[model samples]
Target: MEQNYLAPAETMQIHELLNFKTICMTSSKMMEGVVFDQELKTLFEKDVRQSITAINDLQVLLGKAPKLR
Candidate 1:
């Protein structure tokens, strides 16, 4: 069996980065409204979801971090 060494948190970070990149690409595509296809729209929607999930996770993680206050 091939072992996967990456932790779930690290995998999530990679996914977040890929999602971010996709969002950037789709945002550019969005500028040319008439040229976008269903696939692009789908990709954009998925990217938004991933980005939101990533943000929420990060917020929770940061909540555990030491604060100045």
Candidate 2:
């Protein structure tokens, strides 16, 4: 037995984009050398670094944070 189903082109395109995201996540997790296909990696890295630096700065400003209070 066989069944046929059809989807519109826009729907197909959205599905493909979702699949691509899944593939990227799988590859990044399973492969050490796999690279991301988007230009945002550099931006993300910079943002992460900046966030770390800010945390460090705040740590110094508060003299080891309010938790030590």
On TM-score, the candidate that comes out on top is: 1
lDDT of 2 at 67: 36
Q: Candidate 2: what lDDT?
A: 0.47
Best by lDDT: 1
Runs off by more than 4 Å, candidate 2: 1-36, 64-69
TM-score for all predictions?
Answer: 0.50, 0.38
Q: Where does model 1 exceed 4 Å of error?
A: 1-35
Per-residue CA lDDT of candidate 1, range 1-69, in tens?
A: 854355656656766765675576567556446546778767666765665666566556544434345
Across 1-69, the per-residue lDDT of candidate 2 in tens digits comes to: 754333455445545654554455444444433447445555554555554555455434434222322
CA lDDT of 28 in candidate 2?
A: 41
